[model samples]
Target chain A: MVVVSLNNVTKKIGSKTIIDNLSFDVHAGEVFGFLGPNGAGKTTTIRMLVGLMKITSGDIFIDGHSVKANFEEAISKVGAIVENPEMYKFMSGYDNLKHYARMVKGVTLERIDEVAELVGLQNRMKEKVKTYSLGMRQRLGIAQALLHRPKVLILDEPTNGLDPAGIREIRDYLKRLAREEDMAVIVSSHLLSEMEMMCDRIGIIQNGRMIDVQLVNDMVNGGNVSYVISAKPIDQAFNVLQHAFEGINVKMTKQHLHVEGESVDVPKLVKRLVENQCDIYEVKQVNQSLEEKFLEITSEKGGIA
Target chain B: MGLLANEWIKIFKRKSSYIMIGILAIIVLVAAIGMTFINNQGTETGDNGNWKTALEAENKDLKEELKSTPGPYKKEVERVIAENEYRITHEMPRVTSYNVWTFMNGMMGLVDIVALFTIIIAAGIVASEFSWGTIKLLLIRPINRAKILLSKYITVLLYALFMLAILFVLSFILGAAFFGFEQNQPHLAYLDGQIVERAQIPFLLSQYALSSVGLLIFTTMAFMISAAFRNSSLAIGLSIFLLLVGSIVTSIIAGFFDWAKYLLFANTNLLPYFGTGTPMVEGMTLAFSLIVLLVYFIIFLVVAFWAFVKRDVAA
Candidate 1:
């Protein structure tokens, strides 16, 4: 089932289109990463989905309930931490949980305890939130969000302030949540590697526009190839091979030829280069990373999103 | 209901709430004790004689004045004499716990100061959420914005009630401890150039409690200001400034302009039970002040509710 859906959702702040014609679906049991750079409207989109903001001209539905028309019911199914999670600094973590739990129906004390344990905050739940480290506070935030067993968890930069271990913990917890709880999790971040490991699929956004949405594997799969071919009489061989494959772009660095093209013509091109008195020594396809794909897509639009 | 409770817990968690109540209680306690001291000092004539002699001197002056005045004022003079005679015969002029109660009752017009604090406290309750970057966690709680705002208002009102109740209890307890608990002595008041006294002290004190309802309404106005401004300093400063300016301007107009009484603050003091003091203007009445205040109160409430529920939290 689709847990949350936005159709043609547009948000404008004065004349600036913050989220223009933005549409996406969060299906049940998937860790959907919302990847974008700063000022890319990632937070704005998440805010709209959580009902903290209104869409300029479109429908946002949570479990089939319209966010605009039935905000209370629609929001009840969504657990989100927008921008940052804030708790009363003076109150203990347990008290904060108790206080937030009241807003969510049927959230028993046992459920609060369970969530605290889930977030690994069982030992420090009695301590004031002001004393908590950023990472601990983040875990507590996640715990608070899950107190009501919400079907959809929308987190914007949930690991923004966490240390490496904290990020790993949150990433692992989110993965477990999607798998064990069957929840649809939408996490936004600027970190590509983190998203690559945590998200099953990613939607790349830039300049308040979603440039592309693709599976992590599909995005990084075979998009780049680095080849090291040795050709003797280097200067003359480079000229001959360059003229034979007019469409192919080659870069000669040190002792290697890095050729990036369709794999289908690579063998033929290798034969052509050899016929031109080019003695090719070594050739290999370099693995492309999600970071490279993210950079390529985001840089095309100057990283506005 | 759950939201309201949560809001209440939030309000109580703040240090300002306790500090406000503590200050109010101290003020009420000091005022009660001060009145008792004044009452005691006035009566302990010692070698110069006692309270009875002072009362006799006052009575003598009134008698002398009555005798000197001519026929046209005779009826008024006779009425004053009758009331004075009753007070003297019944020992109603003596100060006791009733006197402190009566004194506080007379000063009830100043209770609007609570409204100023109410605004200051209530404004920060929600505004601090944004200012301190806590609103993000609050908004993600799967609750409607309207409910959140409503809960805030409820929390503010509870704070106001707690402050008032603290004041009330402190005044009564301190008054009784310092001033002997004498119920037979009448509640003393200087009205219409005569000392009018009530038969029941507790009943008069209870009647004075009605003024607090007006105070509650004023505090509600403060809450609205706080909600609209969303900054504690701005809300508190502007509300207090406006309130002080409102009173000063009303007084100035009443003295110079006939329409001054029409200003809501001019006649806010509702202690016209015996109808002694002149209102700021000719037509000014408690009912008229109440109507004008209510209108402004409703407008403030509407704006506060709307802004709190609709405005964005940028922090």
Candidate 2:
């Protein structure tokens, strides 16, 4: 089920368009990653989703309520940590939770403790937030966002300032929250590898626009297989493949000529290469990782990042 | 109500709030004890036995000085003479001894200190959230921005009242402990060109309330600045600077301009209408000052809420 959606949302400041015609949907029980480089409107989109910034046009709906028309009702179903999850540092972690607990309805002291334990912050909740490490602060922020049992949880740069182990811990917690609680989680980050591990699907944003959205598995393991041909006298093989695969990506890297095409055509191409008196010593296929694909997509769209 | 409680708890949780209260208590104690020491040393001079004769002699010297006194000091001399003549005719004895009531009366100057600290709170209430980067978390709550801003404003007013209450109750207790009580006394004053008598406590409280007009306006201005600027230092610095120098500047301008009567500081203090003093400008009445204050008050609140609710929470 679609739990949250942005419908053609655009944000403008004076003559500058910060976000231009962005649209996406986040489903229940799934982690949707918002992947983008810095200054690519990742923060702006999150801010608009959480109602911290107004959308210049279009609207967002959360759980069947329009964020623009019925903000309180729409936002009530969403728990969000915009930007750094900047909480009151002077207050104790428990007091901070209590402070946010007072703002929403039906959040009990029991709920507070449960969330703290879930975030593994139960032991440190009595200490002042200023005394918390960055990872501890991130956990406290997540604990706060989960207090209301929101149907959708939004986190902007949730892994920021975390150590590798801390990042893995948050990643596991987010996945469990999506799986066990059946919550829709939208996480925005520029950490490509982190998103690949944590998210089932990701929508890549660039230059205030959506470049592409795809499932992580499909993006990495699907579509054209890239064959790297290491042949003797490679110049002849390069010329033949270059002329044969007219519209395909055929490029030479070091000793191998990389030709991206359908797997069924590989044997035919090899025979043709053999006909040209080219010796194919080895033919290996490379499954592009999400990071490589991300680079290709972003660079193909524009060299903005 | 929950928001108010949050804001209140936030204020009181900090050590600075307690420090403010502590310093205020210390000031009252030292002032009271010092005044007691001075009162004991001069017992013979205020013996009420020859008080009328002493006042008559002083009045003769004052009348002689009034003729040669400059224009600015002339009104003060005239007021003293009028007060002394009224005291003799009415047979009201001079305040020859300190009483708890009088001690409390003198301690009213500490109200300004309350205003100063209250201004700090008002300035930081909204702006500090931005500086700390907590506004993002705050504004994302299911509550509307207007309600949140209004709650904050109400919290500021409530804090100011809380501080004032502490000052009043603490000063009252300290005053009683320092100076033993006499009977509830009446305050002597010059009213409408004649010396008149007023109830002591009611009059003193009214004076305190009236003096707080400056406090209330400046606090509101500081809140507006905080909402608009998102910087506590700017809010605190600009508002406190104006609070200190605004009246002096207005009086200086009042010497040369009639329009000075419309200025905020010119009318913030409503005390001039009650006793021996005159209005800063001719033809300005209590109603005029009230209307000016109300206009400025509404303007400040409207700006504060407008800026608070409409602006995006980027921080």
Candidate topping DockQ: 2
* Standalone chain B TM-score for every prediction: 0.75, 0.93
TM-score attained by model 2 = 0.92
Candidate number of the best TM-score: 2
Kindly list the per-residue Cα lDDT of model 2 for residues B169-191, writing each as its tens digit.
Answer: 77778777877766656877777
Going through the candidates in order, the fraction of native interface contacts each one reproduces equals: 0.64, 0.89
Candidate 2, what DockQ?
0.79
Candidate 1 deviant stretches above 4 angstroms? A222-224, A229-248, A264-284, A299-305, B28-42, B46-116, B188-210, B273-276
lDDT of each: 0.74, 0.88
Docking class of 1: medium
CAPRI level of candidate 2: medium
Q: Top lDDT: which candidate number?
A: 2
Model 2 chain A lDDT-worst window of ten? A259-268
**Span of 10 residues, lowest total lDDT, candidate 1 chain B:** B271-280
Q: Report residue B183 deviation for candidate 2 (angstroms).
A: 1.5
